[model samples]
Target: MTSSFHFRPMVLMASSLALLAGCTSSPRTPAPVEDRTTMGRSSTPTATPAAEAPKPLPGSENAGKPGYYTVQRGDTLTRIGLDNGQGWRDLARWNNLTNPDLIEVGQVLRVSPPGGAVETSGVVVRPIASSGPSSSVTTQDNAGNKEPTKESASKPNANANAQAMQFIWPSQGKLISKFDANNKGIEIAGKKGDPVLAAESGKVAYVGESLRGYGKLILIKHNGYLTAYGHNDKFSVKEDQLVTKGQKIAEMGNTDADAYKLKFEIRDTAGKALNPVTLLPQR
Candidate 1:
């Protein structure tokens, strides 16, 4: 017959889509996914099985809010995603990391606001035992406590790093530099993509690319504490991810490093950066 105008129907359809978006619960990260199967064809989703309840997503009722992630044995970044309502891709993106399949025990991860986050190398979960005043009193004491010596502080136990710190090394390497109050972090050198361990056990709060001197950075948060790793070849976990002690959270080797070194920083609940030499084990 004659050509007819039908602008109202298009407007109604667009309005309906906007309404639906406003009504449903959203996910931490949503992306455009292609639908390969058409009306005549069907295919199973590549996601984890539905029978096993997926892990809670960050901020969801199922996913525990930003907090500590206790790294258990046999934990992997992929498993953490499935457990925390995240996927491998999103996890890596959140943590500013490059890998997703590898993660280890006793590592801590922190999930932070958009734009910045921290990841601890070799994260630990348990709190450190405040062994009442040390028998050896020395120069300074926070509260009549004996001054911890560099000798003792150099080699904070690996078990202790897990039990107390909840994080571990970003990679197996020697400490090339110490955490200086003026400088603010320690330096480590290792191979490219070397497994960086987590230092504490916590949820991944944030992961980003804005690390200045640090090439590729990962940030994590623990109970009233935070850790950061920079100049990495890649990251291992995502925001709101739960990790354990000695977990592989990132790969070593500076993105801008001539020698492929790592920059490590730790902060307290008060956001005060602390000297890692006070608690790390001797190299």
Candidate 2:
């Protein structure tokens, strides 16, 4: 009976150790796979778009050409004539415009005469005389008597004649502003209804408020030069009329200005503004 009990205990112990070894030797089940389909996607960032360039102004293609002008917005026939040193009537005839007021933006205009030829019908061409003091030229007559010749007394000097152009003050007032790139002219302080005289003798090319920032403006054409009178209360002269130096052309007022004043400017035929102080007489 004792041998049988010992044999049974040894069998039970061996069976327990065999079961533990089998449990350790068996492979463990893999973990459940994670579901990545519901997670947010990661991607590279998108690039930003560039800004667009500004468009060019109308009629810019014909710019910088001599003897030709590209009509811009707010352009008038009279203003164009003054800028090109041509009369408004002449411009009307050259362009064959029935209505001088109707001009389109981007339209190309002939600023100079076609083929460099000017129409001289019914126009008188007088020779310019020298600016020097006049002197009598004497010639011996047939009877040994000295006589002054009337045919060839004056000599032509174009440069001297051009330099002899004189200008006067448009108003008798204190100067409020000087000419500059931004101003384009000088400002003269005056009372309302003050007389605005012409700075030089010329025909009236424009007399209206069509141009912006120049209310009741008057543009006078002086040969190859142009004078502008702005901010007027009343006009005393008409277009195409001849005006004398120091003659009243308009009345000064606060039109397009901060105070009652006269805005005067001088320009060349190419639309370049010149200093009025240099042209006008000293105060």
Candidate 3:
């Protein structure tokens, strides 16, 4: 009876051990999977577009272009020709203008000589190549005959000796203004209808009120030099009229000036202005 009891207890313990092994071997629920791709969104940054700049106005370009010039307001044909290295007559001929005094703003003109076999003798009357102190007048009579005059006795000796054209005061007055970059000439205050003399002897190149800021203007060409007399009450001489030194060319007035005054200037062969005070004799 004691041996049977021990055997039975051993068999019961073996069965309990077998039951625990089987329970451990059975499958268990899997741990939840971790998501890595969508954790905190993308790390790269998004791009953005930039804005465009404004464009320039039409016809505003080509200011520095050669062989052509775009006319601005207040511009005259004479002024344009002087600015370029040509005579106003040549420009008129090149452009086939019936009236040299008429030109509109924004008109594109040919600054260079025209192509083809064209007569250029029209330019000989006022040649840019014949610039110097030598005075040679080719004045023609009504019969188309060349009239000769003696060398002007009024020409200053200093200027003649230096091979430069002599210049003189255009009117008797007090100098109210001076020359500058913007002010291309000087202003001399005088009485109304005061005599405005020719600074130098030459044929009148232009006479009109076509140019703005200048009233009843007169442009004279002396050898390679040129002079401008502005703000006149009345013009004593007409275009193409021959003028002598101290000769009355106009009557000074307050046409475009603040007072009764004459605006005078002296320009070189290239149409570059020289100080009138520097060229005019001592007052």
Candidate 4:
């Protein structure tokens, strides 16, 4: 009886094990990994692009160009130029202004480095060329810098006179008023509307009328000297202008007298008045 009972229990255990084996998990292929290459790149920092700096557009304000000027009410090319320390003609030429008088309001004007002013530190006292007036205006300097006017006037082919500072005449006329300790410089007499030529070549230092006795005045800084021409009926040149020899600087007239007469003076940059008679020729 005991042997039969043990055999029946063992047989029942084997049947349970056979059922468990049928439910065992099956081997898998990991769902055949999807090809993400068709889904595009990883959109991460390593795969993303970087931003670039913006470039300046053409005609922009900071396009590495020069400064510009605008016209306002009651602004003329000559008047604006004088106020800004520039030459009147240069302003017109820079803007391609058909006529200097035609500069209208809201017009834009260009400026260069050597616009119309004398902006240097040194002053040069040059010499009159012996060859003549035409060949005397040598743009070339001897050492590529400049020779003293005294030296350049004496040398014929030594070199160009490229020195930054040089003195020239303010106006051409009969020097009526002579330089005096009591007075400043000599006076040049002209008609009510005579054209006053430049005494030498230099830049216009000032313009317009501002004095107790003087009617209208223009100041030019040449070499080491500053020349002043007063009592002008009209001025052809403006402040801070680079002028040439024998060029018409102004229309001579009597702003303070019954007739036309120019009260002229020469002063160093330090404001010490000079006697122009000593500097002018005896005619």
- Highest TM-score against the true fold, candidate: 2
TM-score of 2: 0.64
lDDT of 4 by residue, 144-234 (tens): 8754343234434432332322334555556566666667667777677777766667777568764545678776655545566778888
- Single out the weakest 10-residue window by summed lDDT for candidate 4: 158-167
Off by over 4 Å in 3: 1-68, 82-87, 99-162
2 against 4, candidate with superior lDDT: 2
Q: Indicate the TM-score of model 3.
A: 0.56
Off by over 4 Å in 4: 1-175
lDDT of 4 at 213: 55
Question: Candidate order by TM-score, highest to lowest?
Answer: 2, 3, 1, 4
**Which ranges in model 2 have alpha carbons more than 4 Å from their true place?**
1-64, 85-88, 113-156
Q: How high is the CA lDDT of each candidate model?
A: 0.61, 0.78, 0.74, 0.61
Number of the candidate with higher TM-score, 2 or 4 = 2
lDDT accuracy of residue 151 in candidate 2: 54
Candidate 2 lDDT at 249 equals 95
Write the residue-wise lDDT of candidate 1 on 1-283 in tens digits: 2333477778899999998887775655778787665645656546676697766533243233354354577765543543343333445666555655444454454333244333343334455665555544356666776664542333345444334653445556778887664777788777777788777666666565543466776766665456777887777887768877678888776575568888887766434577776656655
lDDT by residue for model 2 (146-260), tens: 9986654565456542355588899999999998879889999999999999887778877888777778899887755678999999999998788787899999988887889
